[model samples]
Target chain A: MRSTRVTRRKLLRLGALALGSTALAACAALPTGPAKPTGEPAKTAAETTGLGSQPGPTTAPGGVPVKITFMMWAWSPENEKFERDRIELFNNSQTKVVVEPLIMPYEDMWTKLDVLVASGQAPDSVWYDYAAYKLIAKGQFLDLKPYVDNAAAMLDDSIYDQGFWKPAKMLGGDSPYALPIGGEGMNLFYNRDLFDASSEPYPTDDLTWDEYRNVAIRLTKEEGGKVVQFGTSLAWLQSWWAWVMLLWSRGVGIVDSHFSPTQCTLDTPEAIEALQFLQDLIYKDKVAPDPVQASVLSEQGGDFASGKVATMVDGGWDVVSFRSIDRFQWDIALLPKGPKGRISPFWIGGPMISKQSRNPDAAWEWTKWTAEEDGQAMIAKSGQQVTWLRKAREIAPEGAVPEHYSKRFETLNDLAPADVWSERWNEILDKVWNPEFDRFWKGEITAAELVKAIAPETTKMLQGA
Target chain B: MGRLARREALECYLFISLAVAGFLIFQAGPIGVSAFLSLTNSELVGTPAWVGLRNYSAMLHDPLFWQSLKVTVTYAVVAVPLGLALSLLVALLMNQNVRGISVFRTVYYLPSVISGVAVAVLWRWILNPEFGILNLLLGYLRIDGPNWLLDRQWALPSLILMSLWGIGGSMMIYLAGLQGIPTHLYEAVEIDGGGMWDKFAHVTIPMISPVVFFNLVTGIIWTFQEFTRVYVMTQGGPSNATLFYGLYLYRNAFRYFQMGYASALAWVLLLIILAMTLMLFRTSQLWVYYEGSVEKA
Candidate 1:
């Protein structure tokens, strides 16, 4: 009995010693702010514990719990409910990690986020519209390459890895700060009824700008100097969607062999030719408007709903909107080949890792999860957006998969030129390029002038702080 | 001092101290920060570096900044006079002894109580391009009304038109001034065998000129600070046709993260407004009338 009491005290001493040593080690190694802004090596808490390059505490004394702050743009009520429910399910499965989501309005998000990031505090992980990755250069976020490299061992190679080219490069071969999660590229969404009335085929894939113009003119109907069913409505319509596809068909683009900002390759004759073709669609053909004169975007949508346009380009994820328009019969087609190539302007959101994280191992785990089938599928189930994961490319472990979810991988081309362009793409596309292109679309400026305007503006936006 | 009296003094200090502290911390601090921020170049993510004359130099060439200033000045120039005139007119009309004058006063005062955003949205719906009720009514008259808020040319003017809808606060002030105008002055003018138009021209015009002056100066000050409506409406777009000074400042600071430049812009605007106010006041000595006046030396 006396020996047993001694053993109990001895066991307590051993446990207390272990706890005390851990506390001392933790005190000795506090997390300093990240070493450099863009390219800090991924270091985990285990390394802080004097655990000789092991990286992280794989298992806890009892069980370590992780908290991940995930943020995205605010969504509709139904979508939010679905996401929260799915997150709760994920939490149940992963006893270690807890994901807390933050949301703000879509349009207002970047402004608020810019402010928040300036304050030197950001969520553990965020839905980074990779276009804003330049903020990484400014020291707001982490270079996720190291962590992704670490997790590559755990990823199911066949299912998890197909769509990645440079793994890091978003567009061609620029810096890769994130993996594509959810996205939509432009697609030709047109009123089929308008096509039927005009005895024309819907603007299907494989049509060139010249071909599209011909069809647009064919559909255009004017009565008493008033357009009853105009060929198309151009709302927020810059040639960005057409430009990507057209530039690729012509092999003239902003990205070079590697995904870095190439010089204005399109500033030359081929790009001029492309612009002339687009111009033909507007003034010469008199099919689409000199979009500059179109009413506001909200009005354009209303006009389309009222059956005023035969063909229009809209985001693919917005299929539900066209589907819900009971007043008009509409259909969507994959955007056709442009003068350049078979490319479409895509908008994609990537998951970004925070620069300052209490648990990078956990954060990285979440990043991998978000990039993997489970995370992508979880986001997809919400139906707010589509995931870029070549979902069909998911080769389940030798017939473990149900058949239906696999086919979706075929349609998931998150690597489209638009998504490839990522965060700063919008700044150029929407802010700089789109405005000048608007002038071109308006015939206020020539295409050459539009190209000249973009060089300085795009150059300014590209320069790192 | 006695202990109780000292305690009383301390208590009084404590009572007012919270508000003073709040004013210093929240208001004054931000203003100082923004001013300091204006003189520096700030990265969106990193520490703001002091770039003494860089932001100002940049501002000289910044076409957007100039455009915004022009728009703001235009908006204020158009909106203030129109708003003040309409308010004064309504106040004068409502001052007549008539049925349910209280109700008329309430109705006139209601709009200004509504916030700027609500009023902007309400007006946007009214002035919508295609399906707005205002256009529908205009259509019946065989009018092909231009898209008011959407078109670059008409957008700023539409905002001006909307400003007239919410002149109630100014109207109430004018109403008070109109009431203060002694009825005996009108009677005296009438006793001179003057007509209604003549009496009003001599008496009513001079009587509320002080109120008009007050409204004018304040209107200009507030107009320079105008941001919310433009932000909500056009975001200074359709080729930045509606870009205003304050909205530009906000874009620089918040949207583009050029906080220092924005701050410098703000200080410059303050200086401009101050100069304009001084000039207006100097000129006021010419036209603006007070209850009693003596010739300047």
Candidate 2:
């Protein structure tokens, strides 16, 4: 007992010393912004296009120097660099429009824009999400119908008809307030090192959730009943593909067809089967971390970067971070097919135009450039952001990304459903989905109750206030 | 010569004009607009229309607003007395003529100087159930700590613990009050054959009563307005357990964009603080003893 007390005191002293430093480190790590005062947004290809050849705003007879800003998120420095190259091309080539780029945080950009637009301080243009069409109904967003019909109408029809653009185009059968920019879909990431080390059969395209579970169970090795590795987690925040798509494969939508929140269908018997399999990795099977243990490690982004888990549900962008993982070879695969025989795919974030931007024309031009094949390709290469454009299949080219990395993109693009387009889109969908989904993942609540839980809030939001 | 009076008045007005302008700009101007907003049914889309007393009537029915009020009151009640008592106890401990006392004072008060968000994030890690040092420490005592921030039942108390970490600042104020008591009074009590307890009981209580009154009133007022710490921490969640009034006001204003409703919430909060402070002053007659001839003062 005395020894325990001595050990206790020593531990506390050490913990305090560690915590003081950790706190200081946290202060240092808090994200900050630019040092200098704000300047014009980063110039885009549209603005800088044909610069020397085009007429100046006042002096030039034909070419117009349009100044515009486009807000962006979720691409690596490499991808951003490629996009920046295109922006220079546009600025140099075209005097018609000057589009600048402004980067925005992706987590919950829509609501922030909504607030901005309501206040009339919106940027000239933004890369708006499909759901940003909600602003059109409020009269906050300008109708694109006139532009789509008239001048500045060089958009591809194939891009417009893609499965993802349908809901936003109709605005749930209303008006199309936004045009498609580029997007990434979620897929399962599998670590090849773990597969070879355990001599587990690599997951195949034909595999079901059951086969996925078998792989997880087999890969899980226990020495003294503690798992060194976790199979999968029903993620709580930011990284939400595992929860959303897995549920989606079961035909449990985050919001219903009309955009009302339905109870978690993922928690239903079929969904529960998937969840129980996930839980078996933790509670019964003991192959994964519990909620507390899961959080103690780095975030999903960091863990995947370090190549810790054998398989995690990841977005099309996950491969962007795999550039440095020397410990293991990895690739993206379709989420194991559920009973639905459909791949669970979701678009990450959508761009929106601010209703209140002073340079609405400039903003529209920037928004157009975001969806253009060249712009999409540029953003993709600089950030390895796989775009949703019909031509995005050419992203990796022949020898750019390693053959293995390129193959993941092909599988993801071919097998995955084009991203779902919907209205009433905001971070609200994220809220109604998680925690309860997490509880459902833990088998704390029945799937039926989970679906019932989110219905009203979803209904109200989808209906819109 | 009489015109000199006008010149003097003009100079006096000029000197005070800047301060008055600032007060009007930052406070009075906003308040006037907010009052106007509270009477109208306004959406950010177009002009707000007059809907007198409608926002107040709506507040009565709003379940979330009431839930927020309940949480705010509970937070204020738990935090204020506990904070004051802890501060008083620490102040008493430091009042003794001990070694390196100034250094001790600085160390104890250091936490108060740390900003709210910094302290909250530190407490978040400390309170984590899985790998936090707090849980680890509690484990040595064989008490399995709850997953504090994640648990609705314990989230408020977890925030209270964070609030308590900064009580050192409040305690320092009390410490200064303690030191201000003359040593001669204790010597007088000693000459009369009074014990240390007697000296403290008679001399310390009356002398520090004014300080206690001041701290109590201000602490309650500030706690009622508390928002930032909770905003960063739980965001009033794990299912609305920590949703205080200020957070509710922010949501009504920013999230829902119901500025008029938020103004009403502000007014209600103002009235609540006024009532509580008035009650404290009314009750101050009994225990408080002031040395000045004006007893209440």
Candidate 3:
């Protein structure tokens, strides 16, 4: 019996040794090579497309001009053309670098970016949005702080708003990843024609939420048993920013006024009241269209632009697209005040250098140039965006602002920093909050119920962050 | 074997090498890698940690996984049979000796040829609650149409209805099957004083049972893997009612970067599909009519 037991033990020992060795072999085989940035981004792009190397201007002053790709989502042909023109301008103004624009549709941007980053062939510089940064921040984006620090004297640090730059650190660490390009503050854009048709006076800048609601309900018109115009429409329904702004106007948010998120304060009475107000606008008052109704009408431009909705909570960035609305006389005003104050949370996005970028120096130069006075001047001239640089805003080309709407920029004074700047903003807002809020939109749930359903999960996410 | 025979065998293998290479590289390799990944914790952005069966076990407890499974199973159950019936009905209609039958077939087949995005966009416009032509037409009939894509109760059904629009591919297959049926069989039925129902039940059904089986299996597989429409149309929204397994897997794999978990989900899906296919094959012996086979149900 003893001899048999010894033999069995030996067999077990051998099996264990073999298994260990096999595991060791697997561990060794599992891609230990560090993901090094490729020699040139353009070369990587060339390889991907099965094209021969693209020619560069040999007469460039700098040795072997750094060829880098700039990635952005071109949602429309007009946007693509505009970006292409600007890239050409950048190329003409530079000698040390040649920027190659890699424009893709907005829908494919995240998927394509993931593929690129995973394959270690990310563009040198890619358009970065704060909400999307956290998902892609894992060893993909370079810490731009060192570059910014080195070029501190040259860079106009004051050009970018402190609120705009504060959230850059929330991209996972106390290091700036992306610099501000352009930003937009929220505004209440109302149709004068709609107001005139109803003989309702135009809403004042300091109009309270109660007054705003009353006016909106009064302006809402139904003729021949069909709604000719809705009272109001709100953009960014799925974005937490909208709710955050509303809560801020009441001096609260998902988080407290710490300017950085820590926990879910959404269950508070004030937050619930704010959410209830928005909910009432859709269901009780029927002033604004429900999400489904809005989606249908918004397809024909937007509720505001389609003239189906009398008022819209829009942004300064909308001015570019809003200019195309020739059917109505529209103007912008400050967001309606809550019991506490009026607050319009600012949103900013811009170019960021990939950590995998081989040409960080050249990329930084390009990024810096993008934020420079000249670039800002061009952006301002386009009248589609709010320039970061104060100087550029001052030098905005003649007729950039509509002659009557010259004081539109005055709404900038009402801008407030968002309370939360979580990297998981995209997931929390789109995945968690919006889906639950959708139930509320469908009238399947009340405001309190919506908050009750969402708060715990949101709190967990915030705590995790 | 003779030298000539051996040479012929070699040529046959040489001709088939490209397909074998493609299968190994694209299909088999990824499948093998996914199996290995299922045992690990791979986020795709960091070093993978070996944690055997943890991902699989974790999914067992995940409410979303269970919800997605229910959604996917419901979608497959409803869509496969409905799609098969619609395609078969369309095929029967197209089989008639009518003028412009080919033109009708081509027109019916157009929706299948259109991209998923275009189809989704078209459907979005058609199903819009307020201004949609569907609702407008329904209003004319005094029927208040429900919000098709927005209402959770109606969303999945709407998708199933939209899926039926692209039944042309299967219709073409069924049409071919119908055309291939021997005329003598129908003539035999007629001579025996078989009515239309008798002929259809005895001759048509048996003759086309193989095609039906094929469509059933393929439809089940395809419906289970329906992602593009769900992603483009609803994005698994209206309170996660349309959160199909494919969309859930995609979220984990790409959006959330939980590649390892996604791989585990893939394996579970593979097993589920395999079991289903085997079950169908087992049942097929009872109903499927093979003309030349010695074994008959």
Worst 10 residues of 3 chain B by lDDT: B21-30
lDDT of 1 by residue, A1-465 (tens): 344555877889986676544432232211223433322346541222111112243333367667777767756775567656756766665666777877666767776566556544457777766535556646556666565555543234443443443433543434456655555556666788888887787664567656766777889988898556668765434545435556665667554422455333557667777776676666776776553235533454554666777877666555544445776677666555654445555555667777765555565655665555566666655444555454522323221221222222323343354433333544455457655664576677777777778866665665531
What shift in Å separates residue A431 of candidate 3 from its native position after superposition?
5.5
TM-score of chain B only, all predictions?
A: 0.89, 0.91, 0.97
DockQ (model 1, Cα): 0.14
Model 1 lDDT tens row, B40-156: 675445566778878888878877778888899899989999998898889889888999999999988888889877887778678876667888898999998876765678889
What TM-score would candidate 3 get against the native? 0.88
**Cα error of candidate 2 at position A377, Å:** 4.7
TM per candidate comes to 0.80, 0.78, 0.88
Assess each prediction's global lDDT (C-alpha) against the native: 0.64, 0.62, 0.76
Arranged by lDDT with the best first, the candidates are 3, 1, 2
lDDT of 3 by residue, A410-458 (tens): 6666675552555555567656787787787777888799889988888
Question: Of models 1 and 2, which has the larger lDDT?
Answer: 1
Answer with 2 or 3, whichever has the higher TM-score: 3
DockQ per model, Cα? 0.14, 0.07, 0.28
Q: What CAPRI grade goes to candidate 2? A: incorrect
